[model samples]
Target: MNPRRKKRLLFASVLIGGVAAIASLLLFALNSNLDLFFTPTEVVQGREETGLMPEVGQRIRVGGMVVEGSVDRDPNSLKIAFDIADSGPAITVLYDGMLPDLFREGQGIVAQGTLIEPHVLEASEVLAKHDENYMPPEIAEAMGESHNKMEYSKGSY
Candidate 1:
């Protein structure tokens, strides 16, 4: 091959390799920071992918309806604890921060943090649904079949 063609081929290969490296690095960063969202039931039952309860201290997300009558707040501190339940199971969450204005029992929410135990999560952040009829899609999917949304909606739950 000609000298000019060889140089061009080498440059092209370098460019492609550089692009691939950057893409892989980006993917690695995203995967590391991305927390898998789980419902209380899934956490209780254990993850299908791993076939085991998440290790204690591994960061993850848990979302579900805030169990009715489970809210407890401290009189003098920001500490608040509540149970979030899906269709079949519930997990207790402990958070010490100003809760969202919309946070309440019977509402859908997501808690981001690490599992403190098999059925407890230490939440670093809590996210409530933005509006009525706006449950998170992951929670909705997890709650189907077993969870009776209508019962909860009718003011009975």
Candidate 2:
């Protein structure tokens, strides 16, 4: 209860409070912007578990190989749709913008968007493998590590 001690205590309390507030704000911003990554199989499982589509549309990234010959594009418009699949399952993605030059069937890709429907993603951005032999690191690691094990089903071209 001494005067000088009281001021020191007050300063310490204020400093700690400020730090906590700032930390809380930073965490809030990060959580709001954080995007979770999910594979097509996981997405399907989620839908099955919830039994309802359209959970919180927190931005998500799905990485997989573009199913061979699944690209569908309108003749006169930028709209395009493709199926992206891993060894497990596939999800259809619809995009309305110019695609990356490297995008093609049987290529690795990661799409960022919202799953607006059952097993469908309305992608806002799409990224394709950069080169003939190169894939995104995530896809590469996943394919390399789990190709055989992740093959939940076959015949999904």
Candidate 3:
């Protein structure tokens, strides 16, 4: 092959490889920035697997049972505080927004926000389990019970 043609081919190959590398890097960065929510059980068991606890101001989701009698709202500020519990520890969440219709004390909830403190989550979004069978799969698995076997209504609040 001619020297000039060989040089041109090598340059093209390098360029293509560089583009592919850049594309892969961009994809990886995007994925890493997209935060995920986890139940308390999941956070306790799989923090290493799921990168890290979101830094302050970084968005995240947390799921757990709403602590009974822990839901309180500030009438003027519209800020709400509730406690979320797993088998191990409970996380206190402060949210400033309208909660979902299903959100209530003693219900399963997934709150999305940033961790302002180690055990305090400042939630911007709150999703409550809709019904007895409405638990997220991850929460159900973490709780070690199949959704089919658990009757939400049977539990006496």
Candidate 4:
């Protein structure tokens, strides 16, 4: 084979191999790290396509607004239960951990854990979701402020 042709073939093979490696890595990362986001309404509507229910030893996320007057903590066990709600039904979340400082009633929260039983989420991780209107200045600038509305109005200020 001509030296130039041999060099071109080698370069093409390397390029193809590199592309395949990158594609494989991307697929692996996506499959491993991707988690589904669901609202309380969706969960209540039975729309979870993956059949990821609140079953023992399963990892899942349950997101909704925390129902007011529904948060209770057991002093000795550190077990906490709160009602997670959307526009429709609500699900109860049970977690045993150090709750986040910002976690409170009526706030949006996403709990990650397994369903110990029907309508009960045993959370291993809890995430407090910032309101849609709350964003960093940079994000606000990039996304625009049209959708941002302060939950607390100037009248309170």
Candidate 4 residue-wise lDDT at 14:
100
| Model 2 lDDT tens row, 66-126 | 8878999999999999998776779999999989988878777889998788689999999
TM-score of 4: 0.59
Which stretches of model 3 miss by more than 4 angstroms? 1-3, 10-14, 41-58, 145-157
**True-vs-predicted CA distance for residue 17, candidate 4, Å:** 16
Better of 1 and 4 by TM-score: 1
Off by over 4 Å in 2: 46-56, 144-157
Clashing residue pairs for model 4: 54-115, 55-115
Error of 1 at 83 (Å): 0.5
Deviation (Å) of 36 in candidate 3: 2.4
Query: Mind sharing the TM-score for model 3?
Result: 0.75
How do the residues 1-157 of candidate 3 rate in per-residue lDDT, one tens digit apiece?
A: 9999999999999999999999999999998677687666545444656555555565678887887789888989879998987655678899888888878776788888887876778887888887755778767666554233334444643
The per-model lDDT (C-alpha) reads: 0.87, 0.78, 0.75, 0.68
Which pairs clash (backbone N, Cα, C closer than 3 Å) in model 2? none
Q: Judge candidate 2 against the unseen true structure and give its global Cα lDDT, from 0 to 1.
A: 0.78
* lDDT assessment of candidate 3: 0.75
Candidate that would win on lDDT: 1
Kindly report which residue stretches of model 4 are placed more than 4 angstroms away from their true locations once superposed. 1-34, 48-57, 130-132, 135-157
Task: Point out the worst 10-residue segment of candidate 4 by lDDT.
Answer: 148-157
